[model samples]
Target: MLPPTQTEAFDELPLVERARSGDDSAFTDLVTRYERKIFRLAKHITQNEEDAEDVLQETFLKAYSHLGEFQGNSKFYTWIVRIAVNESLMKLRKRKTDRTVSLDESIDTGEETVVREIAVWEDSPEDRYSQEELRGILEKAIDSLRPAFRTVFVLRDVEELSTEETAVALDLSVPAVKSRLLRARLQLREKLTRFFRRKGDDVFAYL
Candidate 1:
């Protein structure tokens, strides 16, 4: 088993200082600390467990190799996340290219469009069950978004990164991030509305 992660080991300040000073252990600890988060971000962006794992591993390795180049301007976690996101985006691009030939057919958008309607229900037994179902469905919906929109939504909404931080991670202007997020959310809403149309009355009755 690996050692404790950096978050579990040193505080961020000490970890940054030690990492800056070429402490391999500190870097390892940092990797341990944020590895799951990195993988999660990758999973969100890539929408594939295998790709996410690869992205996570590559991100940490890259971070290790480039540690010397870190200027210490941002928090270490944020810097590492930037790397992870880029890795995920690159993988997404490659996957899109690989599957481009199969894009002619319009397949069903799947269960997510149905589950998005769960938002209409709240506090009832049906609502609770629907919410649980919606969570899984939302993942599929998010996965269906374009890479840029998906990244923005994950950063700005799911991960709750600030607009500035998300912009930095995505290498977009703040306005660009905002615009993408808005469009993504709207698309999600539209997709979810399909389910809502069928279940809206039931949801309102329960509420």
Candidate 2:
């Protein structure tokens, strides 16, 4: 099934009706509409391009199988996001369950990429060279966040979802979402501070 056009109207009703009737093309249209956003959410949560792609494919497949159960109580996009978030969390939990890493060690590993990327974003870029450098740095920094914290921050901050919306998407309580977001921000702040301190020292020495 080909994906539908990027129409701004609420096409969910029609799509849902079609999908409910087992129209494969309608389902395909739905996938086309959301594939990019789903992939991005997966990438941000997983910090791995390969894992993100896998999650995207798995999410849509699962969503397809469960189409009959969809209640249409919410927007289709929101419903899709709920599924994607659950899929990412499931993958993350599975990974953690398979390993036993110390929290301190994990924090150290996460800080390197997060801090480096934060530093890159601050550099004033007057040329293409500088812009490209900044992009690479930011990507690395985003990839450095711990899987759990990274997902929370990306959903709440990067995606600009409301607290309620994030909670719904993650199947988390409002308080849980708030606490996770706070921790993510604190972690990012610490990483960014260290980066700036190093830059400040370099500038002072240069002066």
Candidate 3:
């Protein structure tokens, strides 16, 4: 994975060094800091709690084993995230359930790529939806994405990883990450546009 900004690198240097030097507590501390985020990322990709848990455990196991190869060039978090992402994808591969779009393949964004004006959902919709209901609707939209697109979206947008970080995590080029992210956003916008209108949400926004 790509190294984080200098500030993030500096912040993590001590713990990484300690962990690399066989400090068990330091390794534990690293896990403590990032386990939840990794689990969430795994779950988002696997779409199964059991698979996510397995991925989470395996991610750390691999990380601990490979600590010596870490090279102190990247943020420990970024490295672990790459491991977690790879493990999650491996789980999907084993299941043989998901059809992944190829990052190297060029697919048209439709005949005409006109930007659509999407209506944004407000705090309270006219239909009086509960928060859980709203969240479920969004989740459904996200779940509709292909595995490749979904991974890019989760890493770059949900996890708030930089484009560079996401590119490295997925072993993709920066332009590939950007292209896939755009496709993912456009797909989500299209999927969610109808929901907002159906719920009588107000205010238009670009997605």
Candidate 4:
């Protein structure tokens, strides 16, 4: 949900206009502004650093190649995200021959709704673990989700795209995005709950 600030939004228009008019450096500037964010989303979706890198490269390459086709209908970021999402899914298809889960499938609701009270970890895991360790754990937990849930979660929660933007990027309805996001959050909370529970009194002393 990290959106560009007012200054960033102001800066982006000219870059996009110049880039659209065949200015390579302008396009490069656009890439510089968004590459890290896009890479994070790609990594979460592909669940592999190498694949994520490939997706990132391919996304920008395709965008540059087809820059003219980009109408001003959506934000430049959203347009690039659509490309990245497509590239990541293509990579997944090539990597796995079997059918992947559909985004429309029903979520399992065996567990009770995870209370929001528990959702607020007073001392977040990030405070306890080194950056690298926390990243590993987060990646692992996200990877544990089904492809459908994972994509929605990454786009909506991780990337902080609005529900509409997330739905547009993933080609899902807004309600569908909301449904999957809730399920993804619950599933992730359950995993973290188990992890903290295993750490004994030190982590969950407040409970």
Candidate 5:
């Protein structure tokens, strides 16, 4: 069934109640409302199309089974995001691989204040590459981030969730979310700067 557009308002509380009462259609409606966004978040975390799809299915299934336990402390969306994040992390653990970039790593800057050095784009790469190509480049850079930083980056920057929302979803404090996001951005900038430099394009300058 087609989901209503964002502009089309519906009372989610009623739908939630209906679904809790075994109204299958109501549950389907709720799925329609959130599936696309949840899939995107899963994809960002899993970094594989197939794994993302699996995560999407697993997330909804778990949510359905645990619906009775939900206490309404946070938005339903935030609750489901927490599930997706956990499922994604489980997948990572099963793979027995480590993918992380350190936040404490510092780069030399002329200023007294310590900070990570990131390359500044001279002319936004938007001017040099097609949108599709730039998107591919950006995706690669994001994928290279350590999972901790990547999750925070995806939630706070790409998904545009608020710091509070991100913190709730990841079960972290707001300050932790902010710290991870800052490190994620710095790592991405450094990566893209190196990429453009390696391509011999004067697109970015290292600061």
Candidate 6:
């Protein structure tokens, strides 16, 4: 949600202020800034396009209605992320009514980890695979993760949220966020490990 430059990031406060003051254009601008990223995050969580679209629409609707309650303690982006994530989680909960385990409360260590160490890739993923292929492999793997782990991975790793920002967005303790993030990375690593084995000193360099 944050812009690359600090100046652009600072601009958000003014936009937020203007939007809070009932400036419709300012609100629209804010939506334009983050709608795609929010949709991706929702899709990552729910793994359903329809649910993701619903979450995206509802997120902005709720944000618009609750602008008065925004305390401005957090960045506008982070606040919106919280709403979006909560909505995505709610969607999953509705679909999983038979399950009794809490999404946030679960200990997600049951997945087996790869015992063999995989070599690091010398080149970026883009150097080896087309963007479409990379995205397909990753999205499919990430979609297999549990909702809680997927949320942590998408916010912390994919969206590059700071640990503190993630904690605030998900309303989790810092320690809990760290633990879940570790589990998420481990899960993703295990999934990706199946794709490229350590044939030599590097990952998939021979190919």
**How much is the lDDT of residue 139 in candidate 2?**
56
Indicate the worst ten consecutive residues by lDDT in candidate 1: 100-109
lDDT ranking from best to worst?
6, 4, 3, 5, 1, 2
lDDT of 5 by residue, 95-177 (tens): 65544323233322323223454344556555577888888888888888867788899988876667998888777778777
Comparison by TM-score, 1 against 4, better one: 4
Candidate 4, superposed: residue stretches over 4 Å from native: 1-10, 106-122, 196-207
Q: Which candidate has the highest TM-score of all? A: 6
List RMSD in Å for every model shown: 8.0, 7.1, 5.5, 4.0, 6.2, 3.7
The 10-residue segment with the lowest total lDDT in model 4: 110-119
* Whole-model Cα lDDT of every candidate shown, in order: 0.74, 0.69, 0.81, 0.81, 0.75, 0.81
Candidate 3 lDDT at 118 equals 60
Better of 1 and 5 by lDDT: 5
**Candidate 2, 118-171: lDDT as tens digits:** 333335332334667656655566667766567667877766667888878766
lDDT of 6 by residue, 1-207 (tens): 545544344458899999999999999999999899899999998778999999999999999999999999888888889999899888988888766325666674554343454556434544466788878989998888877677888999887788999998888888878888887788788677665444366544656
What overall lDDT, based on C-alpha atoms, would model 3 receive against the true structure?
0.81
lDDT of 1: 0.74
> TM-scores of all models?
0.72, 0.67, 0.78, 0.82, 0.73, 0.84
Task: For residues 68-109, write the lDDT of model 1, one tens digit per residue.
Answer: 888888777888889988888778778775653221223233
> lDDT tens string, model 3, 1-207?
564543444477899899999999999999998999999999888898999999999999999999999987877888999999999988877777545534444544643235675666544442555788877887778888877788999998878789999998998889888888898888887777666664435443243
lDDT tens readout by residue for model 4, 95-205: 877867455555556343456434344365566778887788888999999898999989877776789998988888898888888888988887776544434444556
Q: Mark the 10 consecutive residues where model 5 has the least summed lDDT.
A: 104-113
Question: Where does the lowest 10-residue lDDT sum fall in candidate 6?
Answer: 108-117
